[model samples]
Target: MIHAALAASALSLSFAAAAHADPIKIGFIGELSGPAAAVGQDMLDGFNLLLEEQGGKLGGHAIELIREDSQLKPDVARQAARSLVEKEKVPIITGVSFSNVMMAIHKYVTDHEVFLVGSNAGPSQIAGKQCSPYQFITSWQGDQAAEAVGKYAQEKGYKKVVVLAPNYQAGKDIVNGFKRYYKEPLADELYTSLKQMDFSSELSKVTAVEPDAVFAFFPGGMGIAFAKQYAQAGLSGKQPLLTTFVVDALSLPAIGDSAMGIISGGFWAPDFDNPQSRKFVKDFEAKYKRVPSNYAAQSYDAALLLDSAIAKVDGKVGDKPAFMAALKAADFKSVRGDFKFGNNHFPIQGMHIMEVVKDGQGRLNLKTIATPFKSYQDAYHGQCPLP
Candidate 1:
């Protein structure tokens, strides 16, 4: 019996030390195809940039990333996740882009006792009653940005406005978030197809209403299509289109001159005044030849967070308790500047009101004008099981 116990202890020690010998593998699943390809590619680039900077290492262990494309489909995301867990055997998975995809794979990842360092797509359900100890969000809740925009609109005395978003989990979250803070009945609350590119009919409805402003949440290609259509409809700046998560760095080039002077809300921009943020922006632009979007910033922070947590764990990826504690500590310097984890594993960060503007060289970009929410905790955190 004593010899058997000694053998068992020896095997456990060998398992813990194996990460030092073999590269610690992590999984990345995102919408790498379809309309949201930009979203996934930006996320991949952000994480890869960090890896290259760190010599392809995190903590004391060499890192190996296994990637899969979700194709912006729920079933595809689920299958990709299963393959990562069952085949790739990655203990940690990150780079989930859209809320619907996150929801599709959340249970599977968490049930397997694997960690999910979600870079985007924090739905209210996960933020609240369904919050998992194995889950951590580097991004804000889906509604947080939209809620800030709603507050801005309310304070600007826009009593009647039209609200529009894609018909999906994230869209519903954004609309609900906007309504939460606006505290007024909207002139029109509308939803478009999740895959719809044409906004002519929606713009027609908004023009007919002639509300004080039009508030919408259209991200990636959808935003580009909507912005072009709205501008072509002669309702962009004239009708006062207010938005969150739109007119960002990724979409600016595609949206062109139409993106200028659009009122939007965001978590970070390249023009921020922090050293870490400045360095990240400079390096990212130097490598990618484009300004990093909110998705890129958040995904970069996830990489930084993993570095800190993995280093703290000392290459023992099997040490789940220590690793979870390290992640919760959030010891890394984020590109977003100051950062920390909320009890529900969502970020407690600031949200700013911004406008799309041109630089001295006439390059379209975002400028932070007002920060209405600082160190903001999401509305659903109180409902989470965590303290």
Candidate 2:
């Protein structure tokens, strides 16, 4: 009888050990297998690189990741978000390349009590009235980068400027953000389709107007197409191409030498002189055989943020309010230097004004011309309720 009782106790202990050995699952959703797949895959690559280096442990629990492709569509993004929260029951959700998809998925997931860590794509609504403790963005709000471009253009004495973006809410937000700072005479405003593949028609209008400079906001696949067309048209190199979130590491590889001499503003870059960024860039390129984009860097930061929050909560991430407060504290070292959360959960970080340069090795890369809006916060924060 004693031997049998001991066996029963030992079995119970074994079961408890097994149960405690389960990994903490994180869901990563983005456009992983389409025109914008590179953006998503790069982000995932960066995320996994961190896990590998850290031995896949966060908050003393083994970490597991489930990756999904949003296909850069709002409905698809919503479906992915539902699966991540409902079916997988993941503790954290991360990665989104496009702003519209992020905006679409934000309310649904946040309402379900799931933490959504945005790697890119900041909508004004998320940063303003609809802000939630469960939602935090590693990337700057979409408008913040645009405002930098707008201010830079004015500083350069560009009297007449033409602006173009996809005909979407996020695109409108970016253009409006730029206008907030530029406040200069506008030559024309053009909105292309979200899936616009050709910009010849729009480029024709831009060149015809002869603006002092051209500012645009195009992300992911659209950026690759637009930059190629803009360079092909030959109006950009002469008039000074100024933009926000248009030319990035993901698009530059596809753009090749076409994007040389283009200036854009962004929160993070692979070339940023920070210890975290240097290690991330080196490891990511070594593993992926290509450069890590801002998407990748932001996704890496998202993981660090989650890990930091999970640690603060003592791995009891079920406490949403406490976990969120930890994230807002921004304790992790970001690849983008010295970042802190603004009132709206958007980052207060410098925006680098980068000019794309081709190295002797024939690879295109961004070199910083100036750091505009040092430790910047968006002007729309006055609308957020968080004190």
Candidate 3:
């Protein structure tokens, strides 16, 4: 009986040691090429900052990141997701750059019983009726920043404005969010092609109407072209420009002289004025030799979130229920202040009116001007089933 007991104790200790020492596989599907590569690369850098600090381990388990580029193509992203799920058998996935890519693999990721800690791309469809328990967004919903912009416009009493987007799901969501709070009707609502680089025709349309403000949402390289063209067309000084996810660190260096004093709404800013945020900014800049954008900030939070949850479960990530519960608990301090999950698993966080300006060192950067929404939940959370 004593020998049998000794053998059983040895087996239990071996199992515990194996669990602690095992390497965890995480799928990183991102837009590593194309116009959005800056976004993806920054997210990876930010996530790596924490992981590297922990000696490439989270919750006492070595992390093995399996990276696959979506190349900003839906089909490519879908196939990558399939491979990660079926072949790699990763229990967790993160680093989706664009909303379109998120849409491509949302069903597959959740249906396969995988946890998706979305670093970006929070479209309305997944946040509402089709919300999944397996999906947790570390970033704000797609429309939250636009909603903040809308609220700012409403507060300023902008009676007439024009709206422009890329005519995609995310663009539509941003437009809808803008219209929701801006009580007044728009002067002109125009959507250009996603690949439409020359905004001359769109600019002509805007110039014809001549509104008090213009709200535009053209991300990645499209945004860079649009901003330059808008400036070149002599509309930058004439009309007040409001934007979402555009006038940030990623685009500012390219935007040059025209980026100054441009206004937008976002959740994170470099000078966010918090210990957590300051530390992240300092360390990230030290490592990357560049300014970190909101995308990077969101991805860093995802890593902190995973670390906290994984530690709680004693590295037994294979146990879905415990891992899910640990995620729901959100036992981590976010780089962004006041973060929590709604019933829909999207972040219930604050939004602020952000502005690009030259700091004391003559560097243009996004700075938080006003906090409009305090712990604002997305409009579609009511449609989720997790009441």
Candidate 4:
């Protein structure tokens, strides 16, 4: 009887060890290559920073992060998503950097019931009537940042503004959102090819229109190219450039003095006066040797959100319904401070106006000017049917 009891106890210990060794696999798909690679790399750095801080574990469970480069192509993104979903079987996927890429794979990810925690590119469709219960965005919608700058320009009495964006879904959404709030005449609404690098011709149009202000939504390397070209054309000092996500921390370093005096709008800035924000900025700079952009902040928040939700579920990510419920709660201390999930699963947060200014060290950085919309909610919230 004693020998039998000892054998049973040993078997129980073996099962306990196996349970402890189970790994939580997380899939991260983003444009790790191509023009937008910097954006994706910043996001991955932020996400990895959080995991590193926690000793590479989440909710007291070992985590295996599977990263795939989408190469900024819809087909590539779709293929990467399939590999992560079908073969790797990650319960959660994150680090989507572009709206077009997200739109391509969102349906497949959600249909399979895998939670997609977005770090960037909150498109209107995903934030509104088409919102999936399995998808959550820590980033602002494509329009929200532009809307903030639009209101700022309107208040400044800019009568005619020239708007330029890549001819894409996000570009159109940004333009529409800006128009919705700007209520001013558009001098020109120009859409350029996504891969078009040389904006000398586009800048010529802006000079011809001679609008009161120039607003754009170029991000990543496109932003660098535009800012440099705009400055070289002597328009940086001549025309007031107001933009969204264009002259941010990520792009400012590359654009340098070209981004100076440019006004942009976003939810978080490196100079934000919150303890969490300060800590994140300081730590991120120490780790990455560069200031963190709004993209990095949002991605870091996504990781924290995952950590919180997984904890609530006690690491039982297999319990899909309960895990999603925990995620919907959004019980994380966001670096942005006043973060909450709208009914549509997008962030309902404030939008602040920022100006690119040279710091005491002569390095260009974003300085918060004003909060145009405090506790702003996206326009598509009411359209979302998710309860």
Best candidate (score: lDDT): 1
lDDT of 1 by residue, 275-325 (tens): 889988889989998889989999999999999999999878789999999
**Candidate 3 or 1, higher TM-score:** 3
lDDT of each structure?
0.91, 0.84, 0.90, 0.90
Rank by TM-score (best first): 4, 3, 1, 2
TM-score of each: 0.95, 0.93, 0.95, 0.96
lDDT (tens digit, per residue) of candidate 2 on 196-278: 88999999999899988999888778888888888889875677888776787778888877788899888876678889898
lDDT of candidate 3?
0.90
Q: Evaluate model 1: give its lDDT.
A: 0.91
List residue ranges in candidate 1 displaced over 4 A: 1-20
- For candidate 2, list the clashing residue pairs, or say none: none
Of 2 and 3, the candidate ranking higher by lDDT: 3
Query: Which ten residues in a row are the worst by lDDT in model 2?
Result: 358-367
On TM-score, the stronger of 1 and 2 is 1
Candidate 2, residue 384: how far the Cα is off, in Å: 1.9
What are the per-residue Cα lDDT tens digits for candidate 4 across 1-387?
999999999999998997777689999988888899989999999999889998898777778999999998999999999999999999999999989999999999999999999999889998888899999999998889888988999899999899999998899989988998899779999999887789999999999988888999898888889889999998978899988888877888788777878999889998888888888988899998988988899999999999999899988999998998999899988999978898888988999999988877788998989998989899888888987
Candidate 4 Cα outliers beyond 4 Å, as residue runs: 1-19
Native-referenced Cα lDDT, model 4:
0.90
Clashing pairs in 3: none
Candidate 3 lDDT by residue in tens digits, 152-192:
99999889899999988899999999988888989999998
lDDT of 3 at 358: 88
The TM-score between candidate 4 and the true structure equals 0.96
